[model samples]
Target: MGREELVRRVSEFAKESEETILNQVRKMGSSLDWSRYAYTLDEKRASAVSHAFVNMYEAGLIYRGHRIVNWDPKGQTTISDDEVVYEEENGKFYYFQYGPFVIGTARPETKFGDKYVVINPNDTRYKEYEHGQQIELEWINGPITATVIMDEASDPEIGSGVMTITPWHSVVDFELAEKHDLDKEQIIDKYGKLLPIAQEFEGMKITEAREKIVEKLNKKGLLVKVDEKYTHNVSKSERTGATVEPQIMEQWFVAVDKPFKIPHSEIKGVKSGDEVTLKQLMRTAVESRDIEMSQNGFRKTYFHWIDNLHDWCISRQIWFGHRIPVWYKGEDIYCGNDAPDGEGWEQDPDVLDTWFSSALWTFSTLGWPEKTKDMETFHPNAFMSPAYEILPLWVSRMILMSSFHLGQVPFKKVLIHGLVRDKSGRKFSKSLGNGIDPLDLVSEYGADAVRMGLLVGTAIGNDINFDESKVKGYKHFANKLWNITRFILENHHEGVPKTLPDKAIGYLDELKHIVAEITTEMEKYHLYLASEKLYHYIWHRVADQILEETKEVFASDEEDAKIAMSHTLNIILTTSLKLLHPFMPFVTETIWQELPQKDEDMLMIAKWPHTKD
Candidate 1:
């Protein structure tokens, strides 16, 4: 399909998918305000994204440069480092003779791009090969001259204590080439085929070229040996499942290490006039404890990523994202919120990376770049809960963008959660045919039961091995709660009393203690602990003990004892419904509607019961 047709179709599909997702969220009882909902591609969000890009560009933090980036050959786009998935695979390590030196490499196909042979400066084995010594390498393609460079970064322990530099194909070699001002050659095309420099191997795929080149090298007596059991990590694109090729490309990037004056900042020890880099802004947000993580160990992971941060490639060769708000009129370039007045300018064909727009989600959803009530009230969100896998991809970028634009962290605290896997600890996937549809479970068991089952035993930042039995158990728990409520309502008096009678005072006190404990657990973000406590208290204490005792009291002929029993039952039923509303909203709300005494129109807005009350 053409680019325009593809974009139109994708946009329609996105809208339909979004509506389907929103309907599911409503069916699952989410409390989000539909009136304030916003999409990343909406006009307001697109404006906010363009405004952010222009501002950052003017601040010198965003630049267009040629640098090595993760290139997804299948997607035909440049992806960020976070989008690359590394997998360990068995491969062969080939040792090839290069004139006087023998070097080891896993990829013989990239040898055509080798520009330098680097050796450790302290390695006595290559001491005779002085720095800048010229030597002719008997390459499979033909004879090529390479300079011997001495550098301490080269490992003397690996391979033959020497390594060939393929600057355009490797990140380390690119950095080394920049450090030593060495030349770079491009031997791999964007389609992963050999370039014209490979001669007979030209136009061959990288895999095919590797086999053919090895055979040629062995025929030429240049192949030393090969290790068949060599295992190494290969980077693959997360989106297309294609091997990621590190290539030099001119793309728009966010300069993470470039210092820019803080336009505004709300973080402690950081002021508007202070100068800091994007890396520092993200690091300070977590390091200063302004944004606490759910799991303390993830803080170390966040710091390690920031310490080794690289310039972010924010451009993508895709048709379905926010088009970069940049125009070119021959040599003249213009970047702004809107297109320039001239008719001769053509806008950039590529779009900005998806994360570039998502980074502005917290504030942009509240009408950023335009002063508004929502921005003032909700810009600094209180909390954010996302999967731990995106700690660097989405979370860190949100912090960096918020700090730069709004001068504060996006949220005060982040609760890192984990993926839900099958019972055998395998991730849910279509190919595996093990994916569980929550809607199907909600259909079998009530929505409240499914919600309770998910939260009952799951801890923060821990993967859930979802068991259908847990949902079945919670389904039974819901039935028990409904039956208990029915019995209490059937036996209770018409009007709720102002205070409990003396005989019911003990039950009231015990209820107060349980409420206090559950409230404390919930405040600490211990949802699992709170759910477990509520499950036990309601099943064992209320239904088993209190109801049995109340039954005897109701059977008495004494009028005062009966009234006290009915009043205590009413209080316990109402209080428990309120406590359980968060976990089992649908069932609790249904029960709340049947009660005679209710303070709010909806149970969601009902005042929480206090221990003193």
Candidate 2:
């Protein structure tokens, strides 16, 4: 979607000021000053992509070729494997008679473009249909000759030996078409509509085609059987929910050589537990700090994906995204940031994949290409945390791309997490009626309440079940913090002491210890652990133990006792607020503003608390 249209639709969908992430700055209580360093991908698309293309071209990493890609017909683009979501849905199997043969298919809607069929040659059912034999069949579309290509190592079979092919749709057919030099004519449009070649079925959507084809089959008595409850897995476009087509198309690719050899290639000593996860192996150490992180237990899965990585199809058959920079002049391809110097040079109409631009995000977002101050300051990112699904699609690519350009990985460590599923463990989707809008949560329970609930027991590489009770509980925590601040202000209206009294010394040590613990856990990408620690310390230690003891001490009315209580509360609460800032920024900041010992106007920018006195 274009930036204007994206912003407009997001605005219309939300009922509140901060419904969508477009309102993230407002929802996160971020400052407008941060906007000066940011620009949208589309805003700098032409120039940034040009620089990247030049870099790849000079490195000999860019090439035009044919590759079998996961093609999203509805979105009319090529999405990476990361975007292909496999879901099991209740569908039907249609068994029918097609001319002189019987066949079964889950998608008869795409049957109009059927080219030819293959059968397992070993099967004795169709003994008459021999290998390399020619057969003629009269079809509803036209008269076409069929050549029998038999005994596929894993051929599509109809009954014992019969098979059929849908050339422009299935991956097997695409491979067969390539092997046998058969032609492919797209019988389906970008919107899943049938082309004119289907005649009466032309221009019908998949659902429309399914209804019409079933009716036609029933009328002809060719509908032998219908399995109404045929449960199967379908690869749908994650962007549009439309079924994906496995068509072979020419696309530009960035060839990142696989880190490991092909599967089952060779093994000398590498075994289970020897190397923990891919992330650990790639764990970067910067100066004195090190980041070793991976999602839950998905390290094995991550290594599996990286070991068998393929060249990324970086081109998309779309209009809006960054257009590929290569220009074609009569089969002589010339690729650069700019268009060719002469006329009749047709620039590639296809745009680069959105991730192709994103793969450069770590550097590009920091004002790369010109060695600007931002680039130098943020050369290697401190951390990269994205959803686990994109580890191969985005993270791996960013590593390779940045390593090539800047001689380093983009980030020191990568933190991965799973999706937010519902109470039943099903992913929250519109079809499941369990999608939660962050705007609704923010409006209902306040922003920090929702955030604390999400972070508090969440582990690296884990999916947390969405529950309103958790948010409600955290909302209660926020209320408790507010009341604690109000109570402290009411009792001790005096300034904070320069030094702590003997009674306050123990409390100060614990606060400093908590700060050290939180920093250690956060360094390992254990932000949730840090939040959990803060929750326990605030509710149990500070509120229940220290505050109660302080009240009793203050009841004595000694001037020394009053000053000690004030000093202890000021430093302890102020330190605790700093520790909780990352997980619950807004709540901690608000509470910090009323405290007397604050070093910065905003807790968000205050110096991090440490264990040292």
Candidate 3:
């Protein structure tokens, strides 16, 4: 279908999801201005990203070169260092022969039709074979012979005393090819098409090739013996579970080591010495650290990732995303510091990783290249709220990239919340079918109710268990607030009292104190504390005490009662909306607009309540 049709379908889908969608929209009201919203696919967002890239390129950070990369054939994309997932599996080591030498492979099937096997020369059994001559390739039963390349990953006692080499399917081969300057014979194109050299196996599916080649080798009497059921680690494509082909190909790369400082160690000392800006850099580094470093040493678990970080690969072979701006002119290529001017070069078809664009989200969302008003005030906003799952993926990268380009952390504070788990503490996943539909929850419980429910028991960096009972409880609290507001409106519709009574003096000061604390906590990225404080203030102080105590006064004396009632109503309504703004932005916005107020006012840009001088 066409692009317009797709957009329409998605819009309609969202529209059909009424109660939940409206609630979420209301929850997100203050933190996000819907009028200025930009999705990744929006052209305005693309234009902003285009500008950010040019600025970074001109600053001499973006460059290109050939490097080893993770390729996902299903998505036709290349992911960065952070995207790869490694898992261990079971396989067998094959003990076989080539004319007169022994070979071993975790993938016994891969040894089929092999012309070479690499044996470490130090292994006494093959020391005499030196340069591809005959050696008795006898196992307990038979013989094999193939060329050997020396490597230590092989065990002399395992199978054939030699590790097999398949440049077409392994990372070990890629490294060895570079060391020997060997011409790589990996003949599969990115599209899984066979190159001319793979003639016999050309046009065969990789799976088909595996089966046919193994059968041919068995028929030719090349098979010596097989060891069944070996457990080992195998590299699978991150996007697709298909076995990865590590064929050599020219691919783009960025040297991430330039921006990262590897910790000092005995074998490798990476400190920059006098040139390093450790003091200022340390401040930014500490900011990225847990605000209050976990007492249980959780940061230690996070160390392995930061300690041995690799230079990232940002280019991807995809039609979507921001395409790398570099262009090629024959053997030499040109990197564009600006949008390519009319020239003879063909732009690189590859797009950058999706994270690359999102790395600029904090600033690009605020007009990065040119200094706009929003850039000046909120470009470096007070804080950032991110789900804890992305701490390693998006948070760390954003900090590094923002520090590199803007000389500041993207946000002063990082507020992280854990995933919403089931009551049994198991993480919700699609495959397990334990996942709760957020829209369904929002429909049943209003947006504000659902948000409050999520944060009720969740501390910073803590997981929340989903319980519909808790959601209904919060919905009941929301109903209390609505009914209480209705009662206040019936008693008093005028503005807050100009003068305070001796009895109300203490309560007014308490109200002011709560507002100040909520404002401080919200600015510091402590939304949970802020929400709870507002809930406490409304339910206890206003609903129970103020309404009950002031009822008799309103019945007997109208003016004085109106003053006290209006004062309490205004405070509760404004504070509730402000506290609820980030989590349930849309509903808060709707409630804000419906409040007794002036025309032409937008709830989102309203000044966050601050402490009095």
lDDT of 2 by residue, 32-107 (tens): 5656554334456457768888877665667778767788877888887788888899989988765567778898
Estimate, for each residue in 1-613, the C-alpha lDDT of model 3 and write its tens digit: 7645755786567557765655655542324456766555466557666665665555444556555566666666666545565668765455555656555555533343344556766788877655454444432223444455566655787666766565555666656656655445555666665555555666766655654555565676666666577777666675676555444455654344444332321111113332222123323354345233242333443344455554556777755557676777778666654545566878888777777778777877777666789877885556666676666677666755665556555665555667789988987877789988766777788766777888765777788888889889888887786677678667655756777666566666676788788778866657778778777777887788877887776777568656765676566567666655665565667667767752237767776665452
lDDT of 2: 0.72
How much is the lDDT of residue 49 in candidate 3?
61
Score candidate 1 by TM-score against the native: 0.97
State each candidate's clash count. 2, 4, 23
- The full ranking of all candidates by TM-score, starting with the best, is 1, 2, 3
> Which candidate tops lDDT?
1
Q: Tens digit of lDDT per residue, candidate 1, span 1-613?
A: 8999999999899989998888779878898888998999999999999999999999998999999999999999999989999999999999989888898899999988686899999999877888999997678767888898999878988777889889999999999999998888888999999999888999999997887899999999999999999999999998899999999999999999998789777896688889899999898888888888748777788899899889999999888999999999999999999999968999999999999999999999998889999888886899999898899999999999999989989999998888889999998988899987778988999899889888988998899899999999999999999889888878876544566666589888999998999999999999999999999999988998889888877777866667667878888888998999999999999889998776787899999989988
Stretches off by above 4 angstroms in model 3 are 1-30, 34-64, 86-105, 109-168, 172-184, 187-243, 258-303, 337-345, 371-376, 406-408, 420-444, 463-469, 486-524, 533-613
TM, every model: 0.97, 0.75, 0.68
Q: Which ten residues in a row have the lowest lDDT in candidate 1?
A: 494-503
Residue 31 shift from truth in candidate 1, angstroms: 0.6
Which candidate, 1 or 3, has the higher lDDT?
1
* Model 3 quality (TM-score): 0.68
